[model samples]
Target: MIELKSAGELDAMRLAGKVVATALRAVAAGAAVGTSLRELDEIAAGVLADAGARSSFLHYQPGGAPSPFPAVLCTSVNDAVVHGIPNGYRLRDGDLLSIDFGAEVDGWHGDAATSFVVGTADQRDLDLIAVTERALAAGIDAARPGNRLGDIGHAIGGIGRAAGYGLLADHGGHGIGRAMHEPPSVPNEGVAGKGLRLRPGMVLAIEPMLVAGGGDSYRPAEDGWTLCTFDGSRAAHAEHTVAVTSDGPRVLTTE
Candidate 1:
């Protein structure tokens, strides 16, 4: 069932969002050339521990998964799109890294993701990340009362399509509340004025996953977790937890 959060519950979720934002920032800053993905995971764990928040990604076993996720953060690099398990792989210069993180505070949950280059970035990769971030902002901006869920998706997809990037299929945003994944699967592409109508208490995580290969084809890695583009092209993912309020769309996950 879709659970509409109250004012107090939104506040609690915002607290959790703050924890997630801090952890993401720390992991991004610590992600330098030669830095192992495991080390970046440790950096996020430290931030969560310092804030007395628990990781929502750690040990999370969604249905149909091979095993429980073993890391605090999803570190997808280069071709890997999402759910990339953190390992001992050391990042090289120009490696595109995507970090996805979630945190729970006082029973509330918040999730977000960011993608960036490790050291020296190619101009094409930089443009890819920039457009992905813009898509995320557009999605968040569309989360307002009287707007349908499709509007949000349309806003996001329009940007990606205009840039000639491929939007990842089958994986999109979701409702976030007491649990990490809730009801209402938010799509990254749709026709406006369709789907569920936006309510004031609704909170959704709008994420845009874009592939630079200009196609939507992707395959799961041998590990059964990490997803890579079929053409081995790089990808970028961006997200934010937004609250549909009367005034405007309030982005909970921010630094």
Candidate 2:
């Protein structure tokens, strides 16, 4: 069921959202060439700990999964798309990195993701990241009360299609509140007038994962968590948790 958050609940959710934003910012600032993905995870874990926040991803076991997630953040690098576990691998120059994290504060949850270039990024990689960020913004802008969920997807899809990037349809965003994932799945592509209608007090996470090659497919790595592009092309992902209000769409996970 779709739960509409009360004003008080939204305020508490904002606290969790702020923590997520802060953690992502700190993680991004600490990321650089030669930095290990495991180290990045540690940074995020520390931030959440310092804030006295609970991680929504830690030890989270979704259906069909062999085990629970073990990290505080999902670190996807280059060909790896999403759910990339942090490990001992050190980043190299020109590598693209995607960091996804979620936190719970005052019993509410927020999730966000960001993609960044390690060092001396390639122009094509930079462009891909820019496009993904722009697509996310477009989707967020479309998340006002009375707007259909398809409007959000259409806004994101238009940018991806115009740039000729491959949209990863398998994974997108979801409703976030007391739980990290909830009702009303938000896809990256859809018809403009279909799906659930947006309403005040509804919060959603809007994420767009784009690939530089064919929109073909991906596979799980031997690690059983990381998802990599089947064609070995670079990928980028961006996300934000937003709330539909009487006024407009408010982005809760902003610094």
Q: Evaluated with lDDT, which candidate comes out highest?
A: 1
Global lDDT of each candidate: 0.94, 0.93
RMSD of 1: 0.6
Residue-level lDDT of model 2, residues 25-83, one tens digit each, is 99999898899999999999999999999999999988877789999999999999999
Give candidate 1 regions above 4 Å deviation. none
Query: What is the C-alpha local distance difference test score of candidate 2?
Result: 0.93
Residues 134-229, candidate 1, lDDT per residue (tens digit)?
999999999999999999999999999999999888989999999999989999998999999999999999999999998888999998899999
lDDT of residue 188 for candidate 1: 96
Q: Model 2 TM-score? A: 0.98
Which lDDT value does model 2 have at 182?
Answer: 94
Runs of candidate 2 exceeding 4 Å displacement:
none
Q: Candidate 2: worst 10 consecutive residues by lDDT? A: 214-223
